[model samples]
Target: MFGSLPLGILQLWHRKFRLLTATLGIAFAVILVFMQMELKEALYASAVRYHEALGYDLIMLSPKTPHIVAARGFPRNRLYQAQGIKGVSSVSPIYLGQAIWRHPSEPLNRRSIFVLGFDPDDRGFEKLLSPTVLQRLRLPYQVSYDRLARPEFGPIGQMIDEGMTVRNQVNDSEFTVAGLHAIGSGFAIEGSIFTSDLNFQRMFPERSASVIEFGLIHLDPGAAVEGVRREILDALPKDIRVLTRKEFAQLEIDHWSKATPTGVVFGFGVVMGLFVGAIIVYQILYSDVQDHLQEYATLLAMGYPHRYLKVIVLQEALVLAILGFLPGLVLSVELFRLTAESAHLPLEMSLNNALTVFALTLGMCVFSGLLTLRRLRSVDPAEVF
Candidate 1:
């Protein structure tokens, strides 16, 4: 069957000005959808960067621990019990807390910072922090500061690089920036500081040695993570929770995605983008169909089937999708880079994200075309004079 694609393409281009306007509308919609989704993804990516940097197979936490930022301490004996599991190799306790960082440079300025205390001997986080940096952390009051922490922390990273240990207040107690790491910032906190568990206790003397915030479980080679997780979950008391490192990271993501208002806002933005795009595309398609109604009526009188007209409209919609998507995709990539650099976020453009947005664009245009069909179907052959 000879289809109406050629005619559809010709008709769309015939009105060059309208065609350009429609194309721009579609592109705008694409950019909106792209940025909304990319920002949501970036939030999760940056939130989990800390977890991803750790070299551990399983993560153990207190059941009260909703997420890393609010982690509560659990009994150290639970970690010992985990080490006895069949596939278990070793378990390292990690202490987590928050402290007000009194800016060393500005006495009046202060901000909250995350604190991570781990046994220097375990070296569980050695993948992210070099041995030398971890060794430096062993010295009391000595701590490694995140290089990517927000500037409010008073140039802690720079001070460390210059071979100077700048003194600052951590929860009203004095602490030093002995080294620098690049763990990046999260939504709840501006930056993070790493130190030995002993030093951490020295800074926060209220924290007990018998309680730890997290337990990093390293399994023997070829160990089944799911099985170990189940084993640990069943063996541990109700106060403890055991999960694979991946599951732990997802726990943090899920907390941000569903448990917080930020997730709702981002999701709402995405939906609004789609709605805005659909409306714009529908208007363009409806206008085109209206302009060509007399011609469509004439064609129907000439015995062309209604399905042929539908094909033409759909082809036009698809063309708009492709043309709009190309520029939108390019713009989104550049925007993602700018966001990552300027905002110090981990925003990225992945193939999956691209494919997802492309599918949404196609659906948006096709749905718009469907709405335009109402006008096409109403064209009566007999109405044409």
Candidate 2:
């Protein structure tokens, strides 16, 4: 193995251009795979963030909903079932839906916005806000919105102050912006205006309050979540599914991974990376074995075992893998960062992900080395000369 490392390095140096090309191929594949992983995280994070921003530990939705990340919606009526579970503390049934907010008073500024209906006086409501929010809480009907999405909405705390009731001109009802809250919005929905359940349902009366969507449940301190989860699941009717925080999160993530085009596209990239790596590594190693057939034959003629040649090839392949994967990984980190910043999406490069890449790269090298076994066994000094 030791001897083979120098031999592999020397050969790679001799075929610098080919090595460069193969390395570039590997890098491109790694970068794409990394991007997909990041997007998956973002998709999951965005959904969790929406709920988590409310400072809840467990989220219970209508039984039929697979996960929040997928196409998720409920009648806003099922929020009642989760409100009575044991070990449960504060519970707020929320009505989440969308409607156009025509700032009748502002004219030209009418825009569609998200509607979150929660009790401002609910016991757990204070846990859900930032200091900025607590300060704005005194303002009637105030809500949070992200600055990045609504640059025109003025600064946080700035009153878009002068607006008439939120007319779901389509539904023909009205609500007013208490103010906006900043839980954030990106890719999922635009952030502009927000209002409390009292105001929200009034404007969108065509919507329901008791027909609340999902409920955010807070577990009593030191409680057993698994036991509590099973009890909750067993208690709920089949029409609704119950998931613990982690299980619910995973389900949502898997649903998005399987159902979305972005998921499919990224999956293909990972497969292609493995395929390209195998092809390039196999062709190069096989060609090198054939080129050096004479030298291998001479060694065999001098009583070297055929297995020695195989060992040398395997070692060389491994060394090449380490050589290539190290640089590819380092470069991938930087490339992923640049892609993330420009794309404005989270592209996480987790340790597990990197290790998976490294393992795949090494597997490709081993596979490529094995392709030379038959040729190595048949080498003859006469044939080479």
Every model's TM-score: 0.91, 0.77
Residue-wise C-alpha lDDT for candidate 1, range 149-259, written one tens digit per residue: 888777777777777758888886788777788888756767989889999898788889899989889999999999988998898788898887788899999899878
For candidate 1, the C-alpha RMSD (Å) to the true structure equals 2.4
What are the clashing pairs of model 1? none
lDDT, residue 79, candidate 2: 48
Index of the highest-TM-score prediction: 1
Residue-level lDDT tens digits of model 2 in 46-98: 55556455656677677666544233455444445555777877676666766
- lDDT, candidates in the order shown: 0.85, 0.63
Best by lDDT: 1
In model 1, state the lDDT of residue 134: 81
